[model samples]
Target: MFIKECAGYELEKEKSNTSEDFFNRSVVTFIDGSEEKTLHVLYVRYFDEFIQEFTPYQQDPILTKDNIQVTFKDIVALVCLIKNPGLRNRKRLYINSKPEFTSYFQDIDFDKLTDVVLSVKQNNKFELRSPLDYIIQTR
Candidate 1:
């Protein structure tokens, strides 16, 4: 079910130029009867090369999902996700890491996490609400 929706979304991408339109429209129902279809994985191709240059000496790396890896592209999307949770923020919660980190997203707690910024769409602009105020003006 998810695979088909993802495929459809990918196919629609070639026809639509609207940034917000590039998203999966299906919702997932959990065993607890909860429904959610939030932004999950972001595969950024442009920044793949930068992965080799990122040195994680400043702090311990984030705990990623088992068998899951964080690439440079993921980091780039994460940076954007933190800056503007609304940039194609079709997904309910995007960790750039994995969807299982619900605690991290709900708490908005960043003890040793780098590039951790909470953002939202305010007045049609990307308003940074943590660490510092990094205003991103959108057209």
Candidate 2:
């Protein structure tokens, strides 16, 4: 499945704020080749904190929404290095190292999401590659 759309907004903060207060709320929608959809609401934060707690074997942290909690893993995908020429590029270190866990989707224009090429997760690795390469590799 590829990302069909991604939209987000910053959360409000009070005068007295902590590190946790700095985050954005995003909703990502995925569509498979057969047109099935999956939606995920993400609370986006700094990558440093997320990476510190990340481990492949451990269960991901639970997400709380409307008083309900759910545990889920972030989507792991490959983004085309050449798409979205108008948007600012992400840092090289963040491009291929980890999954799209923390800052990958931060501050991006949701409308331009469809202008870029995206690959669905077929495995646990992420890399900077052309969309065609991703499809060939997965096949």
Candidate 3:
């Protein structure tokens, strides 16, 4: 699904079913030829979860409407900035990382989530699909 077409995201969708063992696993190969299992980003389905995850301590009232769209690249970039410390750090935390655990998303345009860009594939294998593999155009 194109980022523009996405109405919103669901975080609970990232959960692993009891029957599925190998889910949301990707082998990312860097320029140096190193590859490893990488955990992709998750879609925040519930707005309350998004608020609680991103603004748990804040006293400010959130008024943003539901179904805010966000791109896959920005989500990954947000992960790199908020969650991962460095290259090795990213790989180490590749398995089952959550967006609510990150802090960078709070500082960026997450409030204006509709401006984000990325494509999502709605199959059993790739739901919150990344913009890699020529799936998304470079901005």
Candidate 4:
């Protein structure tokens, strides 16, 4: 299942764009075998940002369930699920990578033995709706 994780939340693409339409727990597919899901294996797409954004989405039990179709509001509910602990060991932050390393979603990635930050200095910067960006705008 991990091998088939979606790469990221695909906004423009739509399986069922109609309001109140549900697309529970099914892998959104293309005509061919190649699929267009919103998750990526290793979660290495944009490590730090991915971590920050994905953290809130990971612990969501409803959003994480199998084949349950939902609407945009369901996505909001997913954000809410971040704080609710359905499991015995739920927490605000996943605990795997810390020095003690006792976090969930730690194994979400490929279970890489090493926690290395791969760097790629790029010329372009993607605009984001983050607190840092808001601060940069006001100042």
Number of the predicted model whose lDDT against the real structure is largest: 2
Q: Residue 48 of model 1: what lDDT?
A: 31
Model 1 C-alpha RMSD to native:
13.8
Steric clash count of candidate 3: 7
For residue 71, model 2's alpha carbon misses the true position, in angstroms, by 26
Clashes of each: 4, 0, 7, 14
lDDT of 2 by residue, 1-88 (tens): 4454433444466566554355544433444444534343334345324633542223333333344322222322212222222122
Q: Which of the two, 1 or 3, has more TM-score?
A: 3
> What residue runs in model 3 are displaced by over 4 Å at the alpha carbon?
1-48, 52-77, 80-89, 92-104, 111-139
Q: Candidate 1 — what's its lDDT?
A: 0.29
Q: For model 4, how does the per-residue alpha-carbon lDDT over 40-108 read when each residue is reduced to its tens digit?
A: 111111223333343433332223213442222222211212122231122222222332221322323
Better of 3 and 4 by TM-score: 3
lDDT of 3 by residue, 50-129 (tens): 44555422322223224432333224433332233243235433333454444444444443332232222231122223
Off by over 4 Å in 1: 1-37, 40-46, 51-70, 92-139
* Structural similarity to truth (TM-score) of each candidate: 0.26, 0.28, 0.28, 0.16
Question: Which segments of model 4 are wrong by more than 4 Å?
Answer: 1-7, 13-104, 108-139
Give lDDT: candidate 4, residue 125. 17
